[model samples]
Target chain A: MSPRPETAAGPAQGRPRVKRFARAEHRVHRATAALMAVCVATAACLYLPFLAQLVGRRALMVTLHEWSGILLPVPLLLGLASRALRADLTRLNRFGPHDRRWLRSVLRRRGGRPAGKFNAGQKLYAAWLAGAVLVMTGTGLLMWFTHLAPLVWRTGATFVHDWLALSLLIVIGGHIWMAYRDPESRAGLRTGSVDAAWARREHPLWTPEDGKGGRGEEE
Target chain B: MTKDENPARPAGHDDDRRGTPVGRRVVLGMLAAGAAGVAAAPYLQRAYDETLGAAAQNDPTGLSGLLPAGGGFRYYSVTGSVPDKDEHSYRLTVDGLVRHRASYRLADLRALPQTRLVRDVQCVTGWRVPHTAFEGVRLATLLDAAGVRPEAKAVRFTCFDGAYSESLTLEQARRHDVLIALRMQDRPLGHDHGGPVRLYVAPMYFYKSAKWLSGITVTDHVQPGYWEQLGYDVDAWVGRSNGRDDVPTT
Candidate 1:
């Protein structure tokens, strides 16, 4: 009687035939991430039309916004399923106690506090992004299927859809500036993996705990 | 519009963190979800089939509407939630200012001469599902049965769903591609996609194609349909409105 090699895997080990991040994975994420940015921002641009009044640019804003959203899930799904993107997101989602302190200090405007894994700002941003994306998807579908929902629901959905898009743009704008301003951070997603020293310096709590979602710390 | 305002970038914290290598399980789970959507297509089609009749052709209703704005067309019910397939439960009525008011059964509609059409089904949302086949009684036939008063210059569409409504000008209502669809994709109407009876307007966006269609009332003037009242175009000529610049598909 022999122990089969394929059957040898345990519940704890997880699926090995599946892969983690690879170089090509990084390339895919870079491209997809760029695309995702375009759509979410475009959605934000439409915010003014909804919040105030539907003006000249409002129509263009809305069309671009929707098209962008429709296209966004493509990258997200691709990235999530992608070995590289999964690895990237997994690492980003991780968390630790230092992240807690980061939140506390930021609240106090206390500068230069060393944080573990993703800081509070990063976690909040990630969580907001995840929630907004889901909301957008749901409302977009409602907008898509006119007969599926009532008029009131569609109106409300459209209202929230537009405002959330605006808020996303504002927040995402700040994020991009911070990234581009800081070369090290921007380099990470652009090239797939980040520099080793960059990781340890900022993400002291960084670890590949699989499902711990440590990188972004539960965001 | 600002250069610094790039919404597409990854929203990291004020500081940065390094991502650990990913686990294999996450990848497998995502793959499974993808495979499921693909595998479910056939069963979904069957289920879709069981619910609604075809859209006149194997394609969308838009193809039929593409008939030169003055052509003939058809639409059908295609959902499980529709009222009923036969004449027993169907109700085709004409309300508003009309000299000859009446309600007809499904058998009554079949008794009338039917027309057929082929067109491209376009969505105001920017997607165009092409080459739809539709079969239905000409709206003119229905309008004649309902009888129009001189004051009437509009028509309103009400569906069994009661959630959606649409309006057309007297002229628009008289167009040929506009049909009270009895069949779609050449099958009996289904319920999920608005079966038993749905309106098919070729060349216009699908929203103009109301599902669960139940009522047709001739009125005084143009009134916006369900989606049109909610930031959608009532006319919905492909690539003309709904904020997109998509090229019109014939």
Candidate 2:
């Protein structure tokens, strides 16, 4: 048989096509996730020990937390430089009509609607995390550069930063649990690819496309 | 006030009570050790200050402020060591842009009517010592005695440590709460606590109250303090500067 054409078309006339996340998208996702994990872990280490004085290691921990928060945006900023990543960002920004249905279905313990590359829940999570990171960065900077803001602003920033930090912890926990329950979803993040059947089952609306996350040519 | 003419007696007096007869070599060794201890005390205190500050910094939660002010209070000196001054050597000079240039010894300051203020001592770094009683001659009295020049807009402070400096506008300097604090917590101010004389700007962050105060210079304009030069606010009203309003310490 002739060598299978290296295209999104198909392996043959009868074979099912396998769509996968683009390599760039996968790389950006993994890098962003890793950066976020580092930031969250550092923040946790610094804040979880409520009695830092008793621990007698507060200065080092604070410095670490400060630096990690300052650097949190770097990975995503770099990833946004990728055309593919930017497109993904746009997709994540818009919550579709199906998203509410998908959320309702998830709550009902049943699949409600087909999703694209990302479901409504995933999009909302990404959006929320992005917003949270922005808030954290703004408030953290205000706290770090003491003279940058007035006392009232600083006080407000501190209160908001602390509350948001706790909220992010909870949100991240739920996200991890969801990922844990779905091996294929985790595989998509890990290897940048998922089986066509898994993708179809989970995200029924996601279609194999030329440039978007979809079927790749047979190796 | 008794002059400490025999400074060496106190430095190594504890070591001398070991009960051995003073041999020639032992005497020389005792004198040498006393001199070294005196020289090293300030630096040793500075190290202790650094250790405490480091501990506070290491705490990410900033709960270290709740920790006992480490041996009653935090001790910090910009200069590693400052020479001790007794009554005879200590002089607080009020000069520069003043009509009446006055110099005060510790005795002269003590003779002046003392005003007591009980206010919270708040560090810009977030630690606070609450309701610290500081008794001293009113800075207003000293300024009135000096007759501040009409052109003077601010008061500049210089510390005996020769490094730390602070400033306040003439208006701020004259607030009733402000004092040339000579005593802290009912005791004569210890050297560790900016003894003999320290500016106590009760309403402002502690940094505004320059420690080891030696000179009060009336300047035509406000002068940025030691910490102010390094990004701290010139007017560090408690709960206002350093991007924190933990609570009004005062």
Specify the highest-DockQ model's number: 1
lDDT of 1 by residue, B84-193 (tens): 44558778787787778878777777778877787777655333455777788888777877678999888899887555788878887788888888877788656544
What TM-score, over all chains together, does every model reach? 0.44, 0.48
The candidate that wins on lDDT is 2
Task: Give me the displacement of residue A161 in model 2, in angstroms.
Answer: 0.9
Tens digit of per-residue lDDT, candidate 2, span B1-250: 1112355554532221222222223334433443343345446445755797467656776666433233235555555457788899999999999988988999999999999999888877544666789999999999999998898899999988878899999999998999999999999998878887899999888888888899999999998988788778898888776665656755
Model 2 superposed RMSD (Cα): 25.8
> Which tens-of-lDDT digit does each residue in A1-219 have in candidate 2?
123334343334333435455566666666667767767765654444332212323345566678777877777776655655654555555455566677788789986565766776777677667667766777788778877866655555655565567777889899989987776666565554565666678777665443233422222
Q: What fraction of the native interface does candidate 2 get right in terms of contacts? A: 0.03
> Which one is best on TM-score?
2
For A62-170, candidate 1 gives per-residue lDDT tens digits of: 5665676767656566555444445445434544455556767878888555654455566556656665666666678667676677544554455455445556667
Q: Tell how far residue A97 is off in model 1, in angstroms.
A: 21
User: Per-prediction interface RMSD?
Assistant: 16.1, 34.7
DockQ values for all predictions? 0.04, 0.01
Residue B15 of model 2, lDDT score: 22
